[model samples]
Target: MTPRTPDAVTVFGPDFPFAYDDWLTAPEGVGSIPPEHHGAEVAIVGGGLSGLVAAHELLRLGLKPVVYEGARLGGRLRSEHFGGPDGPVAEMGGMRFPISSSTFFHYVRTLGLATAPFPNPLTPASRSTVVDLEGETFYATSLDDLPDLFREVADAWDGALDRILHLGGLQAAIRRRDTGALKAIWDALVPLWDDRSFYDFVATSEEFQALSFRHREVFGQVGFGTGGWDSDFANSMLEILRVVVTNCDSDQHLIRGGADQVPRGLWSRRVDDAAHWPEGTSVESLNGGSPRGSVTGIHRVRDSAGTATDRIAVTDESGETREYPAVLATCQSWLLTTQIACDEELFSQKMWMALDRTRYMQSSKTFVMVDRPFWNDVDPATGRHVMSMTLTDRLTRGTYLFEEGPEDPAVICLTYSWMSDALKMLPHPAERRMELALEALSHIYPGLDIRSHIVGDPITVSWEDDVHFLGAFKGALPGHYRYNHRMYSHFVQQAMPPEERGLFIAGDDVSFTPAWAEGAVQTSLNSVWGIMAHFGGSSPATNPGPGDLFDELGPIRLPD
Candidate 1:
């Protein structure tokens, strides 16, 4: 097997194989709009990463972007500081980023932010990994050091993927950027796997069925890459295959300051090459240094003859309504139905069904600031670090330790769980969640006093409970591929009726690969192209956008 290189693979899409990175970095820039629409305000409904990315690019393309954010900037890329501005932060959401996310890294590097390898289970970045399951504990620096059962389970997964999904060939095609080979392989698998669940694939596979049930259980509890996969067992196999083929699970890193910096940076950073705006102009400056209040309603303005026009009217919380040539919605799909009152005519019934059926997975993370990286202290009897990066079937499914410096305070993600595991702590408060996490860890490290190292109050978040964001990210279920296709392809308005045009949607949920920042960045670029085309703009001859090649390379439509 070929060793995976961080730069070799990217989220270039088995669904839509477009080189967004090249298009973005093109010398000609994203594209140019007509002089008539140079300063025409385009309403951006959310201030999250997707919204901010689209706003920044639109600003550079000579469009006036009026950003409206309900709660705060950064959305799911939230990082909460424990003490002062310079204090340690608890990443409430989006802590790890895979190096395969090239488009996302484009923004990260452009913003001058720093990053380091995340301490995933058994990774070299982690000093050691401790796997505790069924009240048994094992410590290992590498996979080779673990028991034979561990290696057997790992081999079974590799064998199953290669035999069933043609993992190696598919990944090779992705790495080579061979669109023909990619589409040939992926389009066939889409129909075959989209209607099946991840668990079904594992259970029905010859490799896993030949092994004991214990091996399958162990595989789910301590899965490859990040951690457990049992939570995602019910998700469509297509979703799991995308993650594996794109390398979204491995070679991950965390931003030095926080993940939130990417969005906040895009919001404040001045685009010196802006077409119409001044040299120091930014998304923040264009929106008066802060975004407008929450959007209350989105309606279509009609002419005196009662015919819908091109203008879309957006009403803010303050009761002020403004008309814009285009409106980009980057908020959670459910919000369009729950919080905002969107006009029925804005989207077709099929598109509305897609939006309403989009499912979001639940997630909860608890963090605590420690006095120092005390976990590095070694135990005389065991000759191992006091406590290593932990993965367990216990309440605390995963625990990650972060160190800034020996002298500076550190942060520990006591628990990071998704789906059912996240729901276990949903009803608890921050302090209680920390207590439960500590109690779970105590059982693994018999005498380790993790609470003694704590210096600040604990921070916790259950994304589902937050009304602004109903869930963490989209987790497509079996038989929902058609719905996903509808949402993802909505940006191309060339075939849409006049009433169904102008309002665009971009976010990770609307993408084929959700829960990754790369999806948000890619979808935002798609909307940028869609909005530019709506305003009589065209891509450079040297570099065409996603919409330019969308018809030829768009996702395969699954029969309804």
Candidate 2:
């Protein structure tokens, strides 16, 4: 049985400018567009979550949005099927999503998608968990079930939060939306923590320093929230603090059916009749069921006489060109440099530097389907299930189990590794990866014949090897705070020159929280507002937009 929490934990609210949940519930559409401009088309590049969100919202405001996706709809939210469309799925990209992702959840709930609590490490959803390290094995059902030493390490982590970061206090300020209080606390710490690495913060903490190196090693191996964070030790402490303080790593859930449904649903969903479109208009119908051809180049549009106008022109791979008054690029920022041919003057040199300097982490996952939820079988001798959600210092850093029903085919993420660990499997075939994972699992499960229940083919992914996606997600390293600041602020194109005014950027990487889907949602909304305002439209007076409140609630800027 899962052990109960020894104490109550604080539930923090989202730490961002936008309150998307509220907007979704009572959406006073953005300022109305003049009748003449109601049918104006807006180019939405990248049909991922951000781009879809932008397009969906834009369509509601009586505008026509044409989405240009280079590949599939869901960018990093890929959920691949195994045997057939009805077969068990392997979540190749994002799987677990935090409940605090209220904005992203708004759409999930709106679409009527079912969700189950993600079995994160020793959480209650997990029947059992085994932590293996250096040939030592420990079984636990909750934090209370771990050894007392583990408890001491956990307490030290909390103490570090209270003393150095004032996590609870900051969370309170964010919940209250006390801009002054939040800014005062966060701005002061931005400089203090931005330049420091997460490892440096942990090493210098009095609580951690009092503990032995073994304790630190254990904490790094099986950290709370999102499994082992050792891969992120070299990243900026501010990034780690932001994740923890905002509650981005806890109370997570996975979308039932698949995460891809969110974007696809938006694509085929028809909204009420608006400006140029009839009552049944949808993104699918707008582009005739698929995205426009892959975009090859982007520059300003010219008139019949060849004089460039304020409109932006996008050229597809087949040499078809379309011009729009404004464009939102929601693809990975790295694509601007590697895949697409974008004019250098479209972005300032500093902005270009930030885009190019953006860092992405490597991530790998290998999954397989079983005949049944075999892990649920009881071992009479040990009085434990045959298998449990496993975390190990071995080659397989994390293993997750998912069951649809008692007899239904279950899924197992044999291995989920990051950074150097992920790179180790980059060259291996799926079968070889399964072999390596099974070998590593043997160390934890002992003599168990775990392979007997296997049903169909295995699936594997090494994000770094994918040409379209050079890496998994941004893992901001020290000194990257400035770069993030630059990227996040690019939506404010009103301050730019006329030539650079038509392009708006939105994506998870452009958000303060680089890896979370909420970031993508919020940043996309920012672009939505920017695009509306650009077209001489305004959000209802009752609901001022992000741009309207930028002076009061914008992200905290740090000193150079």
Candidate 3:
């Protein structure tokens, strides 16, 4: 738990390298359970990506997982249609995903989903970018086009990464799946950074401190990987390092149809060749073609046989109770604290602290469908696109454009704001929010008649207002490392008493790096290991599961 010095950062490896994809692809199928318990039922409390991924994996391993969803299947990966069922859509939650998310991309590629590079600020997908701050505006095709101050800021960030985090080496190690090399670097950093803030890392680093304050301001305004990182300033430095080092915030792409397809596909995907069930067995079929209603209560119960082992009794919104040998709760952590009537004995006091303290960031997205990609039109005089992908200090923090084609409708994310900016628009109606966004943009694009191209109704979301999910995603505040440690490692059920061992938690919030689908996938994989072991099933010898190596490479825990 003590901070260590005199170590080099190598590439970070995947937390679990057991490779579910490889095991599933093999003909032998990951080792199955005894014939008597081949079809044991397990309850999955959410139909989001994490729950769906766990259910799918369990199904492959011969477990019957009944999924219960409160609202929708996709959860945060929701895509809202503007015109029709097959019309242009807006990604309300997780739109862009990085290629480094190997586990998540496994499903994406398996489903044969199409993807295109996300135009992140000044990236290649964007033809041009407009940076507006403090009533000043600048347009650029790439980083080199920006003022020299931006270059200084970028170089300072790169220097900080190399000197403090060793991002390139870590990413390379991750890509190679070199666990030893990754652990050597990450173990050294966990204690030094777990308690530090992202702003502290930037403001105190000699590389950044040597630069002008204006440079730091510009850096916060348009961060290299994700624009306007000021929202993340108060978060744990460990969280920030995890994002940059693992390439989670860079080289991202948008799922072509919708990000929702990943979850929905897993639910409907028939495993005709599954190890346990007969042909045409899918999660949808197992759940009778739809998920059970929202889970309302969860409590521990003893078996009728009076065995020492514990079983979980779950009550849904309809007041119906069902008993299962095990349950996986994947809903937002806050829901467990507020919506669900969970028994105190279900989790330890330390675990409750983690779940109750989990912080979720506020986010608001406003999208408009346009007649075409009018933003792509070149200005007669300036020769730049009429309106570039925008990053601003205005009410409209970030603007993105997605064009299906010149003939088809184009979608524009008018504003994607977080934290304080998100709160500003929370009280306003979607139309009012859009009007305020246009007012702000009109100042940036004075000559362009943006309203003339509007085609369909606008779509908007304030994640904070959703009853199902109180906020957008988990954002680890400074000094929350201990809380995160408890949540992320909840899959190690052996540490819990027998009464609590049968219940598990899995979701993006329970991951080391939250707000990324990669975290969700990896944590779900961990729960699969926990649940498999709970049922006396083990991973194939060829690929030792994460739990098999948890003691050696689990998260580096700092002293309380």
Best by lDDT: 1
For residue 483, what is the lDDT in candidate 2? 90
Off by over 4 Å in 1: 1-7
lDDT of 2: 0.84
Leading candidate by TM-score: 1
Cα lDDT, model 2, residue 70: 76
TM-score attained by model 3: 0.95
lDDT of 3 by residue, 1-560 (tens): 11111231211233333444444455555556666668899999999999999999889878999998999999999998877768887999999988766668778877788889998888889889999989999999888998888888989999998888877767666666677877778778777887789889999998999988887787787887769899889999888888888677888889887899999999999987666799889999999999999999998876578654577889999999999999999999999979999988788899999899999999999999999998888998988889999999999989999987877898999999999999999999989988999999999999988899988667899999999999999999888988988888889888678767888999999987788997888889889888988888887776667787788777777788
> What digit string (tens of lDDT, one per residue) describes model 1 on residues 1-560?
11234438889898999999889888878899999889999999998999999999999999999999989999999989879877887888888999888889989888999889998999988889999999999999999989999999999999999999999988888889899999999999999998899999999999889999998899999999998899999999999999999999998999988899999999999899999888999999888899999998999999999988989999999999999989999999999999999999999999999999999999999999999999899999989999999999999999999998987899999999999899999999999999999999999998988888899789999999999899999999999899999999998999998999999999999999999999999999999999999999989878989999999999999767
lDDT of 2 at 462: 94
lDDT of each: 0.92, 0.84, 0.85
lDDT of 3 at 245: 80
For candidate 2, write residues 1-560 as lDDT tens digits: 11112222222222344555555556465556766777788998898899999998888777888989877899888999878888777899999888777778878876788889998888888878998989988888887888888898889998998899988878777677565776778877888887899989888999999999988888888887868889999999988888887788898889888899988888888877455678878878877788897788889877899876898989877899988999999988898888889988788889999999999999999999999888888899988888999999999999999888899998999999999999999999999999999999998998787798888778999988886778998989899888998888777777888878889999988887888888888889889888888888776778777777676767677666
lDDT of 1 at 474: 96
Instruction: Show model 3 residue runs off by greater than 4 Å.
Output: 1-28, 302-309
RMSD of each: 2.0, 3.2, 4.3
